[model samples]
Target: MSRIEWERIGRERRRVSRWSGGTTAEIAIHPATSQYAARNFAWRVSTATVEAERTDFTPLDGFSRILMVLENELTLHHEGHGTYRLRPYEQNAFEGGWRTSSEGRATDFNLIYDSRLRARMSVLEVPGEAALVAAVGSLPCEEGEHWIHRIWYTAEGSVEAADAGGNALCRLDAGDALLFAVHRSHGEESWSLRNAASGRAVVIESVVFS
Candidate 1:
């Protein structure tokens, strides 16, 4: 099994729009033709700029959603679910079907996944000159399963991904992302995410298992 197959999604591919108060830049969507306007995607990832002071979130029934603030602060009020206060890098997962509204001027990262898949999202803060390791192994994999994807988004500063041998695999700057597809039969694999910037680097990491 050839592992470590990855793709670098540059800023150019991020389709951005400024026609609304909540301008969004779509990073990627599964199925290649999943329509955001039609809400028919298996999974989708993107960033949104919340310019309005108070914005009502669209109800997306039959989907699970995760939101993380990338800039400024945010407060989410999900009716029937409690309200959540989120700072930069902080996240809250809620049902997309909730009557949700928010108050904040911020930039945020989001993930929406259908019930057919299980997903997890987290943030990695790497101090200057330091590194964090991402390891995938047999624990999460069952007997010969596939369809696992590990995605990394550079939210702040710069980062470098290296293999166990310390050989550089990829370097990502802010607003850029990398996607890795690994088969469970590969047994195990790991990567060291290093802060290649002068200060610190923040990376949004997500794992989707189907």
Candidate 2:
């Protein structure tokens, strides 16, 4: 997959629960397309929910998923295997249909990717000024790289970002996000998000490419 161009992924203004488990999820690219909706997949921007009492997931037929704990702490127990604990920003990948289990309640992010489109998926956290811009810009520079970049800034202050078009993508206050896409062959973009408040801002971007 190509690098994730500058985009933000964090919290959104929506939430849902699909499977038997009350495992509600917020979406960035909410699988509106036939191929995506039928596959029950999405690029999880940010999520927080109760842990499964038992293994509870709908299981995909032709897809897989990647998960990363954004905040809080939790343990994951894969059926017969031992339990694994994940810290903030830790990542893991598993078959979408694999019967796996969880151990505790915590918040996390997930990248739901189609197996037919790519073999694996990745999730990353970007911090600071220059690095964030470089990481996000890389996605659009590579060939065949296409991505829907979602950014959210939950810091106590305000943050701003721009696209190659020089249009203001987002001017975020606390508990807000700026969502946009970076297509193949897009030109260079610039952004300046500053914390108006005392707290620092957090950025998350999910890239789906091959």
Worst 10 residues of 1 by lDDT: 136-145
lDDT of every model, 2 decimals: 0.83, 0.53
Candidate 1 regions exceeding 4 Å error are 18-20, 137-145
| Candidate 2 TM-score, C-alpha based | 0.68
lDDT of 1 at 88: 91
Q: Point out where model 2 deviates above 4 Å.
A: 1-12, 18-21, 30-37, 40-46, 52-54, 79-83, 119-132, 135-137, 140-158, 164-167, 173-175
For model 2 the local lDDT of residue 24 reads 52
Task: Tell me the lDDT of model 2 at 67.
Answer: 73
Q: Which candidate number maximizes lDDT?
A: 1
